[model samples]
Target: MSETFSDDLIASLPVLRRFALSLCKRGDLADDLVQITAERAFKSRDSYDPATRLDAWLFRILRNAWIDMTRRQKTQGSQIDVVDNPELISIDGRDVVESKISLNQTEEALTNLPDDQRAVLLLVCVEGLSYAEAADTLDVPKGTIMSRLARGRVALAKQLGIKS
Candidate 1:
C-alpha cells in the first residue's frame, strides 16, 4: 500500500474511536481498542484488498478485536468498570440541562441493547452508513441488518418512553 493509503487509514482514527466508544462505553477502553485496531490493521495491511472499502475493513478489525477482548475478560472472570469522562459527556454550546438529560437517556438506552443490535444501529444511524454498507461491515445479510436496526430503534424508543 502507498503512503496515501496509510494516511487515509490514519484519517479514520476519530471515527474509529467514536465507534469504539459506542461499543465499549468507556473512553479509556475505547482509546485502547482503537490502538489495538490500528496495530492489527497495520500488521495486516498487506491482506487488505484495495477494491473493498477501507473503513469497513478497519471496523471489522475493531469489532473482532473487541469480541476477543470481551471473551478473554469473560474467561478470566474480570469485569471492566465503566468510568464516565466528563469531557465525553459535555456538549458544547448546547442547551446544557435538557441536552444532557436527553443524551444520558439515549446513552442508557443504547447500552441496554444487545451487542448485535447496538452494532448495527451505531453503524447505520450514528456513523451514517447505509443499510447495505452496515451489513457489509458487520458481515451480516442486509435483511439481518434491517431487522436488527428496526428492533434496536423500537427498543430505544421504548426505553425513552417515545411512541413508536
Candidate 2:
C-alpha cells in the first residue's frame, strides 16, 4: 500500500470505532473489533481498489468481523460482559444530567433493535451513508436497506416513547 492509502486507513479509525461500538455496545469489544479490522485491512490491502471508497470498505470489513465474532460467541455458548462505564455518554449541551439521561435512553433503544435493523440505522442515520452505499457495504439490496431503516426508525421512536 502507498503512503496515501495508509493515511486514508488511519483517517477512518474514529468512524470505524464508532460503528464497532454501536454494533458491540461495549468499549472493550469495540476496541478489539477495530484492532482486528485494521489487521485484516492491512493483510488484504492489495485487494482494495483505490477507486472505491476506503471508509466503506473498512466498514464492510469491520461489520463482517463483528458478525463472525458474534457467531463464534453463540457457538461457544459464551456471554459477553457489559461494561458499566459512564464514559460512553454523548453530551451535547451544558446540562450534564439531561445529556446523560437522553444519551442513555437513546443507547438503550438502539441496543434493543435487531442486529440487521441496528446495522442499517447506524450506517444510514448515524454514519450518514446513503441507502445505495449502505446496501453496497452490507451486500444487500437497496430495498432491504430502506425497509430496515424504516422499521428501525419506527421501532426506535416507539422505544423512546415518541409517536412516529
Best by lDDT: 2
lDDT of 2 by residue, 1-164 (tens): 67888899899999999999999999999999999999999988999998999999999999988986785565567444446655655665778878789989999999999999999999877676667769989999999999999999999999999986
Residue pairs in clash, model 1: none
Model 2 poorest ten-residue lDDT run: 78-87
Model 1: lDDT of residue 152? 94
What alpha-carbon RMSD in Å does predicted model 2 have with respect to the real structure? 14.1
lDDT of 2 at 49: 95
lDDT of 1 at 128: 61
- Compared with the true structure, all predictions reach lDDT values of 0.87, 0.89
Q: By summed lDDT, which 10 consecutive residues of candidate 1 come out lowest?
A: 78-87
